[model samples]
Target: MDTTALAHAFTQACTREGFTELVEVEREAHGLWDTHTHPFEAKALILAGEIRIRTEDGTDRTYRAGEVFHLQHEEPHAEWYGPEGVRYLVARRSRAG
Candidate 1:
């Protein structure tokens, strides 16, 4: 993966272990990652700023520092940050069951 492109999207620390990867992202403007699902478990932790994750159910949930979210691969979701952007970390682990 192009670390620079990923960085351009949002400044973050990305690391991979086997099929799992974790990324710490900080955005300065409204940012969005298209909706999709993988065969793994995904989690995002709000470190400083705020963001919202839109689930397939149309439920929108906001998270801030000290908050964490967990989603399974079967659960498709889209993500977006607030007007001021967001600072958070996302981690993914395989669930290709």
Candidate 2:
């Protein structure tokens, strides 16, 4: 996928969807993160590389470039990047309902 193009499109989509605080994130290779929760709803688009997200229910899903993922407010999860690391665009919004 064209990461640069995807990032730009992702940012635009986030704004159109009423998401604020959009930002770019890059993780290091082989990075491992512990369980955590989001303060608000969040969404992200995978621009490059891959990530494995572990939900509170113990399900692990790996997302690669060109995929999107979301988390509800206060959702519990953990994530780690593949050996080559990952880059993505993320946006957050106030929770409704």
| Cα-based lDDT for every prediction | 0.70, 0.90
TM-score, predicted candidate 1 vs. hidden true structure: 0.64
| Model 2: colliding residue pairs | none
lDDT tens digits by residue: candidate 1, 1-97: 3434544333242234332577777987688887987677766666677788889989999887667677877788988888878876677777555
Candidates in order, TM-scores: namely 0.64, 0.88
Q: Judging by TM-score against the true structure, name the best candidate.
A: 2
Candidate 2 Cα outliers beyond 4 Å, as residue runs: none
- Model 2, 1-97: lDDT tens per residue? 5778887888898889889888789999999889999888889998888999999988889999999999888999999999999988889998876
Candidate 1, pairs of clashing residues? 40-95
Q: State the weakest 10-residue window (summed lDDT) of model 2.
A: 1-10
CA deviation > 4 Å runs, candidate 1: 1-20
Model 1 residue 96 lDDT score: 51
lDDT of 1 at 45: 62
